[model samples]
Target chain A: MERKVCAHIQCRLGPMRLGWHGTIQTVADVIKMLFKEVYAPSGADKLMFYLAPLIVLIAPFIVCALIPFGRNLVVADVSMGIPLIIAVNGFGVLGILLGGWSSNNKYSLLGALRSGAQMISYEISFTMILLFVVMISGSTNLMSITLGQEGTILDWWIFKIPVLGIVAFILFFISSTAEMNRAPFDIAEAEQELTGGYHTEYNGTPFAMFYLAEYIALVTNSALATTCFLGGFLPPCIGVAFVDNYLNMVPGVVWFFAKVYFMIWCYMMVRWTFVRPRVDQLMDFEWKFLLPVNLVLLATGAAYIVIWG
Target chain B: MSEYIILSIFLFLGAFIAAAATVTGLLLGYRTKNTANKMAPYECGMETIGNARIQFKVGYYLFALLFLVFDIEALFLFPVMMNFREIMAGHTPLSPMIVLIDLAIFIVILVSGLAYAWKKGILKWE
Candidate 1:
């Protein structure tokens, strides 16, 4: 799907051979990966090298449970749902750091360090944006958040909070993209510079684990953005009777996935569009700029709630 | 709550699946390549240098320091923000002014710390 989007945007054939436009390319890649040599470096720290992939792979899946896919489709509607999701995903960086360190390879270690700083800095902004949503929604419960935006389209958090809502949404998008280490922030795995970065020494299933975790994190983060801002599973009602009724006829799960896939498409588009920033530039943008803006947004969000309420 | 149980189970399931896939790959993967290059660390196509464990710069550790401070601050602010609406509406015995003023002071202090880091060039990369 990501390749297909890249092809569409760039005017080229993406995956024409394997399945319909290379739809099953991923399946073929997995099979090849499974049969490939699972090599372990002689100089590597055996324990950590083996453990890092598991840690990285599990973090995203655990967070997936907290996302409310539909009205009642959530796996674990924990009380601390929002904060917990961000915190759990934080663990992925640990795996990356460990993977790089244990690989006993220069490129992997450097890649890990770069990604660690990028992810941690962006995470502060990411959490602040989610806190912005929680401030508006009044509770961290994922269900309440989804149900709170029950009215027309304007009632959604993105439109409901005026200027700050849209601003927070965009900030959330950027920070989450960075946190996931996708294309623009993908210097960790920069093909030319790092030569596969942290996973340089990994092969077979372990490497596949990192690859799968990346996409899983993508879906989890997109679902989070959708649930927090776009109104999870809530049909886009334009305040008219006929249209609203017809829209409601479609299941909330369908709408939920539609929004998620759309957010994923948006991610892919941004990935293919921009060039990655230098490491110093990336850090400066976060600490000097994004963090301060987010802090101010938090202050304004508090003020907005006090006055508007 | 049952929710917590389900979450734990989900976590274990994820771990199990990852472990299972890895084991499956080990069982079925190629074993013929026993060359010294296969066991060596990949530093592009060239031979690797001395060791991968060189001393990193202090800038990396400084971010960790700042993160720890802000992350701990978040742990405190979260509970207050979560119930800020209730506190303002007189649901609690405490006055709303006390809460707002406290939050203002906290954030002001945090931002000041950040500014000090910025101006001192602690944020600058070597």
Candidate 2:
């Protein structure tokens, strides 16, 4: 879907050969991946190499359990939703680190090192922004956070607090994009530099695991953004009674997924328009620029509530 | 809690699905004749050089250290941020001034350390 979106954005057809405007291309790719030869280099640490993809694949799976899909559709509506998500997502980084170390390749090592630093640094601001949301919502539970954005669309977290909320939301979008290792912040798998990075040695199913995990993380992050900044599962009604009633006719789950996919589409749009930064420049941007801004934003939120509330 | 139980199930299920997929691929995947060249580590189409375990820059280690310190602080700050409004509204037993002063001190110390690190050029890649 991302590829198709990118292709159409560039006024080109993608996957014309596959069924239904290449909708089945992903299935074909998966089948091809499963049948491909799984190769392990003689120098590779076989145990770690095999374990890495599994660990990477597990992070998003666990997060899925924590996120509230709709009012009552969540798998696990844990109280520590945001914090646990941040912590669980770190496991993916561990998997990449192990995968790179076990591969025993210079490019892989460098890529892994870059990724570790990049992600760890950006995560500070990411959580800070999440903390900002928790402050506004007054609860750590994901469902509560979503419910706090009740009423009109303007009641959403992004618009609830005037300048602070949107600033934090934009910061959240930027850092979350970086957190997921999306393009523009994808120094980890800058193929031009690292030739597939941490998964450099992986082929066949293991490579597919990494590939699938990236997409899953992408969706998971977008879903999180939808839940946090946008009004999750809440229709975009502007306080008109009949209109709101009509909008509510559609299920909340539909609104939830629609918002999630819209976020994903925005990601795809931004991804295709890229200007990759030097590894050093990228690090400086996060550590120096993003972190301080996030801190100030949090302080502003605190002031906003104390003064206005 | 039952949530923890469900979470554990999720973890095991994820790992199991990943393992099952890999096993299925191994079972169905065709083997090719192993060549020595095919088994060597990639080095951008060049021959493998010195061990990949060669010395790396300390900048990454420095960043990791800084991250470890800050990340824990952020975690500690979460609970405080969540209930800040209620506390300010005198819902909690503790006075609002104490909480305010504490957060101010916390952020001040955090920012100063960041400034110190910045001045020392620890964040610089070189």
Candidate 3:
């Protein structure tokens, strides 16, 4: 199964290990291995270039499976679902790098390099935001976090304190969007500027897979945001205490998806409505703005609990 | 629990449908040809040239490095956040002031790193 392939690769090549190895174990290596035996480089031989991209495109969806929707709905409910999701994303980057490198185009290579930086940069804050959520919820189990928000709207972490929660929500949303390579943050594949970006040379099913992965990731990030800050399945009203006890009447599953798609709609709005920022501006906004703001918010949340409790 | 089950079911079904669609498309759309031209890397309708991989700027690597430093530091705050109530509520002899001071020191160290990176131009967009 594709899940097995990802797990196998994920274990031997997790982010920390892969980061240390750098470009040696990247997509370029994958292509080189494939072609090490082949001699000719022309005409009908050009078709193999399509295979790597196709595989890359389809990858994110498989990883998305591991992301739990509710208490029991994930493919593999590893306690570290958050890290698993992040690792899956890291794998998605290698696919892009390989697709770009294998194409043997200058533009594609440049695009891949840009994407590598952009991904590694946003992932830091993105991972930090998840850590913040986990800390507030007091559990690494994502399902427990969603359940903690069950019943009342106030149960949601965002509603626990208006200003800090909202700020955290906004920060999580922005960093996740950039991490997923969506619009406004999708400079890696800007068609007019980078000529279709990293997938420039890909075609056929390989291209289709990468295309599918993008949309799937868009949905995945939305689902994660829904669960993390917006009260996964709980409706957006009423008292936390009242809902927590009685909301169990309706199936938790339904509430879970209702929240997930609602978040997806919000993501779609940003993707379609905004003009993309330049790469430099995106990095500046993250390092200078979002990171610092989250730090301050964390401190505030800590202080709030300290004095108020 | 039912919620997780439903999600897994939906996920598996979605993946199955996608795979089927992909296999069907591959069968229907792509031509099966045994030709040398089809196997070569596409280079905008020309012969492939030069190594595609190149060394990247150290600045990007610096950003990644800086990210790890701050990220790990942020994680240490979690235990403090969760156990703050107990620690302050006479669970441990440490006073609230002590906890706050300890956290302040950790954060100060983190911020100083940021300042160092900034002064070194590692955070610069240029």
Candidate 4:
């Protein structure tokens, strides 16, 4: 009974009373508390793997909340919105490495290495795509870009540039998917070969948070596509002067989310419809195709901005 | 602006709380239950071990190199599509021809490299 009192204080009772005594210290009545003293690993081992990834994965989405899709639906309108996102994206890689490393498994280490290489490769191309859009719109602030396309479908970068628009969309989609470690690019989480991939060793709620972080990343990536490439929160045919002006009645936030989810559908389709390539093939695709093409695309966009804008 | 500020704060706080919980759990769960024999880097549980970080096959590196080449190529076409209108604006009557020819050249360049690699059997799975 005296030992039970010490347990109630919530102090670390390592190896004190075998396993039975750990179960008696609950918050309820002493008897019920006694029954509740089901002292498991207290889930500390699993928790050790979650904190870094949670921050890395969730921070970018938080920034996305500030990026307005339409007229008035942004969280914060920072001038360097695009740069901010890039930094956030870069930051997420650390959490991924930490998760893989802290798990302390060979497969996890390999997954981490693969993830690091893949993310860095794709991030270059992704940034180029962002720059392409920013060049066309003449602003990095998502709101300004939307406003630039406010009164016309033709004003949207997609219609304005044609081929480059398609390229940018594909680049953004592919690179972001790679960044999120979705299938076809999800070599990091290849279950058949790598066990559970990076976090295979993780158990309990820590694992759950990692799962949540992935979903959050998917949502964040989709929202970014909407804001950067698709006109955020604007109707498809709001080109007419009167219609665009009058359409202001609808809240911009709703339209922003609609565009975001449409992109999410695109992302899901990619995941569902494809088989993952071998890691080497994935790397080859990135370095040979993504890097050069994005470099050219960046140059072309820059040239166009200088010549036309 | 204030709405934006509040939202940002909320997001940061949420992330902070989640991070704190995870860290706390990790700290509590850390243990050093090492057995000296089990702790070594797996010499099949024999006396000791050789170099742990053994080199993989050269083919792996070659495959990675090829991927690097192609991924960059794909990125080049992105901006062309985005700014096609500006480039083809004044050449409207001649636009489709120009677009077709430009893309044809681009595709041909990439396709040939793919063919070269394929013919060399670099693309074959071992």
Worst 10 residues of 4 chain A by lDDT: A35-44
User: Which parts of model 3 are misplaced by more than 4 Å?
Assistant: A1-75, A236-249, B1-29, B32-50, B54-56, B74-99
Measured with C-alpha atoms, the lDDT of residue A281 in candidate 2 is: 91
Clashing pairs in 1: none
Kindly list the per-residue Cα lDDT of model 4 for residues A72-143, writing each as its tens digit: 556677765675677677677777777766654566657766776778767767876886786677566667
Say which prediction, candidate 1 or candidate 4, comes out ahead on lDDT: 1
True contacts kept of 2: 0.74
Candidate 2 - CAPRI tier? Answer: high
What are the chain A TM-scores of the candidates, in order? 0.98, 0.98, 0.77, 0.80
lDDT of 1 by residue, A43-159 (tens): 899889988889998899888888888877888988899878878978999999999999999999999998998898888899888888888888899889989999999999999
Which of candidates 2 and 4 is the stronger one according to TM-score? 2
lDDT of 3 at A244: 50
Residues A1-309 of candidate 2: C-alpha lDDT, one tens digit per residue:
988988998999978789877879999999998998887887889999899989998999988888788889889888999899989988888998999999989888888888888888898888889888999889888999998889998999999898787888789889988888889889999999889878788899989998899999989998999999899888888999989999989999999999999999988888999878889899989988999899889888999888887
Q: Once all C-alphas are superposed, what RMSD does model 4 give against the true structure?
A: 12.0
True contacts kept of each: 0.68, 0.74, 0.25, 0.09
Q: Where in model 4 is the C-alpha error above 4 Å?
A: A1-50, A238-249, B1-11, B20-126
Order the candidates by TM-score, highest first — what do you get? 2, 1, 3, 4
Q: Give all TM-scores, in the order shown.
A: 0.98, 0.98, 0.74, 0.66
Residue-by-residue lDDT tens digits, candidate 3, A1-309: 122233444464332333343434444433333332222223222444544444454446555665566566756554556655665566677767776766666677778777877887788788777766765676655677777776567779887766778888888888888887877798998886788787776554445556667767777787778778877755565755676556666765687778777677677667766889988888888878877777777777767767765
Per-residue error for A44 in candidate 3, Å, reads 14
The count of residue-pair clashes in candidate 1 stands at 0
- The digit string of per-residue lDDT tens for model 2 on B7-122 reads 98999888887888888888889898889888889988888887888799988899999998888998999989889999888899989889999999999998999999999999
Tens digit of per-residue lDDT, candidate 4, span B49-73: 3432344445545555655564455
